[model samples]
Target: EAGVVQSPRYKIIEKKQPVAFWCNPISGHNTLYWYRQNLGQGPELLIRYENEEAVDDSQLPKDRFSAERLKGVDSTLKIQPAELGDSAVYLCASSFGRGRSNNEQFFGPGTRLTVL
Candidate 1:
């Protein structure tokens, strides 16, 4: 019955350091997603997980960014050797998988990352 949950609502790190964020989707939700929001831009989908499989991740930066959803539940996103450009709000969202009439996504308060 709980909404999505995310941790460390704010994070600050020097450039080139590594940063990680976590999220727990709503119970019974079959889909989860990770998104990045740069200042003045709308959130862009980084990855989408249907159950435990990553159904889409073309926008994710494989060079320094990675993510995983374990056992089809909680998920984590990591950015290694962070860059100043990587500073943004990392949002997590969930919803019932596609094919349903009411598959509206529910979003969590994003983890704000600052690269100094």
Candidate 2:
């Protein structure tokens, strides 16, 4: 019944540096997603995983961003050579199923990254 958990609620780094965020989803959830929310905007899906497989990642920035859910439980998102525009809240969510009808995602307190 616990919600997803994310680490390092806030981070600040210089541009061109590297940073990483971590997430641990609910115990029974099988699907995980990473999202990014800019100021005054809704969360945008960056990548999605069903178990250890990455099922949807079209929106992810392959050049600088990467994600992985190794054991289908906890996940990590990383951004290398971070840019100033990369400052945003990175959210982690999970759901019990992949089907839209039964998928009710639980979100974690996002990690707010500030690229200076």
For candidate 1, lDDT tens digit of each residue in 1-116? 78999988999999999999999999988899999999989999999899888888899999999999879999999999899999999999999866432579999999999999
Tens digit of lDDT per residue, candidate 2, span 12-73? Answer: 99999999999999998999999999999999999999999999999999999999898889
TM-score of every candidate relative to the true structure: 0.94, 0.96
Each candidate: what lDDT?
Answer: 0.92, 0.94
- Clash totals in order: 0, 0
In candidate 1, how many Å is residue 100 off? 9.2
lDDT of 1: 0.92
